[model samples]
Target: MMTFRDKTVVFNAPKVMGILNVTPDSFSDGGQFNKLDDALKQTEKMIASGATFIDIGGESTRPGATPVTLEEELDRVIPVIDAITERFDTIVSIDTSKSEVMLEAANHGASLINDVRALSQPGALETASRLAQEHNIPTCIMHMQGTPETMQDLPRYNSVVDEVIEFFRAQIERLTANGFEYKQIMLDPGFGFGKTLDHNYEILKRFDEFTQFDLPVLAGMSRKSMIGNLLNKGITERLAGDICVNTVASLAGASILRVHDVGEAADVSKIIEKLNQINV
Candidate 1:
């Protein structure tokens, strides 16, 4: 269980974190929830569908995606964060790499900092450390081979699983040395961020290796090219693929499943819980 201020998220069973990309080009549901009302509506839908957390991203982190200015990212996400926290009782995760955005999101009531850059952006680590001390918020660090722009350009690893484990080790050590408690950290394997299709599947096959950290492992493969490219499907048609991958992830000990399809992912979690309860 992870506690943030007054919110406590129990991970005894995998939890579903709904994706809310409030950008114009996030590969899947971009420009769909940029507006405040639309964002709130989607938040309500996800919550009602059993989302334990709402992950709001301002900047598009898609491969080759253009970068949004800090002010633009703040403008895009803060108001939505404000609205969601005002209306919903769920935990809000700000998906940003900028220190300024993280500060503002925390001030406005975000409980988790889910940085795709894993706090590598300038001042991000310091800012997150301070936030962890001040607000008791947790951070989810993802492993990406390169920047979103160049990440997909022939990304390579000597051994994806071993390399990712090493990266997590270094990050955990760095974060702890910099004043973050172990309980305040989470890990994400970054399904498509900087990986080829084979690399992604390999990580999934070895997903349990991440559980060695004893921290929450987040699996966010909803509507990603990893699935669409593999099945020759479009973004909308990848629900079955998403559920399949998330099921595998849950079985492998993922504590959180970040997904666009919250209802389906929630059902997957329930099924996994029941299966785990089998006595025979």
Candidate 2:
């Protein structure tokens, strides 16, 4: 269980985190909700459908994605976050790697930090630590071999599972050394960040291994290349595949499933939890 200010999210069941990309260039839903009204409408829809958390991202971290200026990123996400918090009562997960952006988003009512880089950016660790201490929110640490601009260039690892475990262990140590607690942190293996199709599937197959750390694990494989490349489907047509991925992750003990299709993911969670409860 993680508490954010006055909000507490208990992972008694698999939680669905709806994705709200407010950028104009995200690989999947870019330009779909760059407008405030559109973004707000989407937020309402996701909340009504049963999303426990809404992840708002400004910059596009898609492969070979162009970098946005600090001011541009702030402009894109802050207002949307403000509107969502004002109109909704769900937890808001800010998907950003910049320290300033994270700090400002927290001020705007961001309840969680979902940094893809895992708070490894220069001032990210300090900023996340301060926010966690001040707001009592949890931070998600993801494992990526390199920057988004070059991560997919030729990602490699002698043993993906072992390497990821090593990375998480080191990162957890660092976070604890710098004033963060084990209970206040989560882990994400970064399915496609710097991995091949085989690597992604391998992580999915062995995701439960991460549970040994005693921290909640998050899996975000929504409409990613891992599914698209494997099924030869476009972004929009990958919903079926995405739901399959979410189901697999949930069965493997994932605490949170970050996804674009909230309703489908909610249904998946319901069915999975029901099956788990049955004596058969």
Candidate 3:
């Protein structure tokens, strides 16, 4: 077990986290994994494709996505997690905002909480802190300016980089003050969440600056509008751009890549890792 600076264990070294969204509203693979067999197959494929972690999300957080009830969300994700964790060696991370779901999922063997809201939800940090303290699961503190429904509509940032940095700083301070383990924490500068194309690239370019906090950075620009807007392609056509974004994020010191296409991201990361080795 890797130790955080006197906090939660690091669980494992930085690795690619595959996205497994089993909802009808996900922008990329909605309705594809609503069935048990399909969900299992996708999980198996991601495992075989070199995913060290599987992030199972039930709700679609894509821009303007409608919300699902906790029961509905649980109905989609838990069984899939139950299926995958039994068959795979990968660490399971639950992507949720509800405190009840987090607690239940954590008890059901989730090792991480990949929260988009960064525990700002009511009782979120407290719930996460309890889980972390008792369960020893690492949590990710991600930055998002607004909710998905309105995030993409006329999003603005005075200085994207500074704003993100400040968000992380404040969240980390809060987590630390609450006696949560800092080492069990990671940070993400939300790429397409409320960011313009230029803002997205700037975050990607300056991603290394986030290392100043001495925690891992998770970059998740998979099939997002950032790529589509830049290349004028649809979601399916964003694979190449996604690979490129993965490469750039790796180069800029991203420790993990959250993606839809696990194999492609694995390939890109391998090549980037090789280049990094040569340079080093």
| Candidate 1 structure quality by residue, lDDT tens digits, 1-280 | 8888678877878999999999988899988999899999999999999999999999999999878899999999999999998888999999999999999999999999999999998999999999999889889999998899899999988999999999999999999999999999999989998899999999999999999989999998999999999999999999999999999999999999999999999999999989888899
What local lDDT score does residue 148 receive in model 2, on the 0 to 100 scale?
Answer: 92
lDDT tens string, model 2, 1-280? 8776688777766899999999998998999999999999999999888899999999999988877999999999999999999988999999999999999999999989999998878899999999888788779999998899999999999999999999999999999888887889999999989999999999999999998998889999999999999999998899999999999999999989999999999998898878778895
For all candidates in order, the CA lDDT equals: 0.94, 0.92, 0.84
For residues 1-280, write the lDDT of model 3, one tens digit per residue. Answer: 3332233333233368999888887988888988989988988999899887889899888888888998998988888888886887678889988888788888777888999888977888889898878877778988887898888888798899999999889989999888687777889998888888898999988888997888888999999888998899998899989988888888877888999998988887777766766843
Question: What TM-score, over all chains together, does every model reach?
Answer: 0.99, 0.98, 0.93
For candidate 2, what is the TM-score? 0.98
Model 3 lowest lDDT segment of ten: 4-13
Screening candidate 3 with a backbone cut-off below 3 angstroms (N, C-alpha, C), the clashing residue pairs are none
lDDT score, candidate 1: 0.94
